[model samples]
Target: MTEPTRVLIVGGGYVGMYAALRLQRELRRHEARITLVDADSYMTYQPFLPEAAAGNVEPRHVVVSLRRVLDRCRILNGWVVGVDPVARTVDLRPHGGPGRVLEYDILILAPGSVSRTLPIPGLAECGIGFKNLEEAIHLRNHVLGQLDLADSTTDDATRARALTFVFVGAGFAGVEALAELEDMAHDACAYYPTIEPGQMRWILVEATDRILPEVGPEMGRWTLEQLRGRGVDVRIRTRLLSAVGGRVVLDDGTEYDTDTLVWTAGVRPHPLVRATGLPLDAAGRLKATAELTVEGARDVFTAGDCAAVPDLTRPGETCAPNAQNAVRQARTLADNVVATLRGGELRPYRHAYAGSVAGLGLHQGVAQIYGHKLHGMPAWFMHRTYHLSRVPTLNKKVRILIDWTLALLFRREIVSLGQLSDPRKEFERAARADREGRAEEPVLR
Candidate 1:
C-alpha cells in the first residue's frame, strides 16, 4: 500500500484556513490527510477589528471558530517554533510547554505576520497594538475608561492626558481605528456633561509622505482632508522618536503627553520563516514564485503576508501584503496544491488590485473600485457592500447586516467592561484579606 500524503499546514489564518478548506473540497478522499496547526483556535476577521474596538461590532463576531470551519482537517492549537525542511518535520511548542516534532509528507507554511514593533523607549510597556481580539477589547475598554477618568478628574493635566489619543502609522489599520474610536468617543461625550468633543485630541503620525499608500495618492490626499475636517491632527513625513514616560516625541521636535498610544505602523513576516533556512527576500518574507511554491522546496508552499509572492500583474513588484492578495493567493495556492497531488497543470497567480475602501465612521467613507472613485454615501455603500460580501460565512454576514440595520435605528453602546481584563482583581483582594486574617467587612472610608 502507498503511504498516505500527509499535508501539514502551519497557521490557521486567512491563507491557511481558506487554502485547507479549498484543498479538502478539491482533493480526493483517502489520498491526502490535512493537519492544520495554529497558535490560536479561532481565525480573526481582522477587517472588522476597528469596529470591534469602537464597540460597533461584538468582539466574538470577529473571530470564526477554526474547529467549526476546519472540521475535516486535524486542528492542533500549538505554536510552531521551527521547521526542518530536510527532515520534513515541524517543531511545535504546545501552548506553554517544551517543543515536540511532527513529521509531514508536505508542508504548507502560512504562519502569519506579527505586529511590527520598533525599539522606541518605553514602547514595550506603554504601547498597545491593534492586531488581536484581546487588544481590540482592551482598546475599547481603555478608551471608554479614559472618558470616565477624564469626567472624574478635576486636574487639567490628567483630563488632557485622558482625552489625548495618539496613533502611529496612518495605514488602513491606524486610520480606521483612529476614525472609528474618535467617532465613538465623540458620541460618548454626549452622556458626560463634563466631557467635551473639543477637548479630545486625535493625532495621527505617519512616517511616509502619504497615508494609505495602498490607495492612490489622490485618495490618500482626500483621506487626509477628511481626517483634517474631523479635527484630526494629521502629521505626515513624521517619525515617533520616543514614547518614553508616556510622552510622545516626534522627530520634528513636537512632544505631547498621552495616556493612549496605538502602534499600527505595519507588520513583518513571521520570524519562523527564518528557521526553515529558506531563501528570503530583502524584507525577510519567504521567497515564493508566482505559483505560490517556495523556491527550491518541491513539497513546500507559502502564501499571505509571510510569503514574498512575485507579482506577475506588476512587472517588477512583489505582491503587496494585503487581505486582497492573501485571500486570492489562498485560492490559487489551493489549486496549485490540488494540481501537484492529482497530476494537473498548476496556474500562476496574477491579479491586479481591485481597489481600496475605508470607513470614516458611520455613513462617511471613501472608496475606489475598478478605477471609479467614490466618496461620502456612495463610498460608505461600497465599503459595506465589499466587506459584507467578504466576511466569511452567511450567518456572520446576516448577523453583521442586522447589527448595521439596528445601528441605523438605535444608538451605539459606549459602555465599557473594563473589569473583563482584570476579573481576578477582586479575587486577589479577597485572598489578600484572607492572608492578613481580616474577615471581609464593609468599612466606611
Candidate 2:
C-alpha cells in the first residue's frame, strides 16, 4: 500500500479556493489528500465589497463559506506562519496563537495580499480600510452613523467634519467604493431632515496623475469629468503627507479636518512570503514562470497577487494583480499541478487584457470594452453584467440579482447594527458595574 500524497494550499482567496476546487475535480479519488489552510474561514468576493458597503449587496453574500465550498479538501482555519520547502513542512498559527507544524508532499503558496498602508500619522488610529467583509460592514455602519451624528449635532464644525468623507487611492477598489458609498449617502439625505446633498462632501485624493489607470487615459479622463459633474472633489497629483490629529495635510499644502478617511492606496504581498525564505522578485513577489511554478523550487506553486507570473502577452512585464488574471491563473495553476502529478506537459499562461468598467454611483458609469466606449445607463449596465458574470457561484449570483431587483421595487435599507462589531462593550460595562459594588442590572437586553 502506498502513502497518500498530501497537498497543502495556503490562503483562501480567489486563487486558493478556485485552485482547490479544480484540483478536487481533476484528481482521482484517494490519489491526493488536500489540506487548505487560511486565516479566514470564508473566501471574500472582493469586487462585490463596494456594493456591500453601499447596501447594494448583503455583507454575508460577499463571502462564500469555504467549509461549504471546499468540502472535499480538509480545511484548516489558520494562518501559515512559515514554510520549510527543504523539509516539506509548514508552520501555522491559528488566529494569532501558538504554532502547529504540518508536513506535506506538495505546497501551494497563495497567501494573497494585505492592505498596503503608509506611515501617515493618525491613519492607524483614525483611518479605515476597505479590503474585507468586516471593513465593508464597519464602513457602512460608520457612514450611516455619521449621518445620524450630523443630523443631531447643532454645531457647524462637528457636522461638517462628520459629513466630510475622504477616500485616498483612485484605483478600482478606492474609486468604486467612493462612488457607490457617495451615491448611497446622497440617497440617504432624504431621510435626514437637517442634511442636504451640498452639506455632504466626498473628496477623492490620488497621488498619481489620473484615476482608473486600468481604463486607459481617455476613459480615465471621462471618469474624472463624470465624478466632478456629480460634485466629487477629485484631486490628482496630490500626496496625503500626514493625517495627524484628524487633519489631512496634502502635499499640495491643502488641509481638511474630516472624520472619515478611507485608505485604499493599494496592497502588498502577505508577510508570510518573507518567512518562506523563497527567492522573490524586486517587488517582493515570488518569482514564477509562465506555468505558475516558483523558480528554483520543484513541487512548489504560487499564483494570484503573491506570485510575479511572467506576462507572455506583454513580453517584458508580468501579469497585473486583478481578479481577471487571478481567476485565469488559478485554472492554469491547477491544470499544471495535475499535469506534473500525472506526468503530462504543462501549458504556459497567456491572456490579453479585456476592457475595463467603472460604476459611478447608480445608473451612471463608464466602460470601455474592445475599443467601444459606453457611459450612463449603458455603462452602469455593463458594470453589473461584467461583475455578475465573474462573481463565482450560481447561488451568490442569484442572491445578488435578487438584492438588486428588490432595490428597484423598494427603498435601500439604512439600518445599522454597529453593536455587532464590538459585542464585548456591554460586557465591559457590566464588569465595571460589578467592580463598583453594584448588582448587575439584569444584563440589559
Off by over 4 Å in 1: 438-445
lDDT (CA) per prediction: 0.89, 0.89
Question: Going through the candidates in order, what is the number of backbone clashes in each?
Answer: 0, 0
Candidate 2 C-alpha lDDT tens digits along 1-445: 7777898999899999999999999898667899999988989998888899999888888788888988799999877778999999998888766789999988899999989998888889888888898998988988888998899889999899989899999999899999999999999999999999888889999999999988889889989998898899999999898888789888988888888899999999988898998999988999998999899987899999999999998899999988889989999999998888888999999989888888877898888898898888999999999999887789999999999999999989888677777889788878888899887664321
TM-score for candidate 1: 0.97
Give each model a TM-score. 0.97, 0.96
The residue pairs that clash in candidate 2, if any, are: none
lDDT of 1 by residue, 145-191 (tens): 89998998899998999899999999999999999999999999999
How well does candidate 1 match the true structure, expressed as C-alpha RMSD? Answer: 2.2
Segments of candidate 2 deviating more than 4 angstroms: 96-98, 437-445
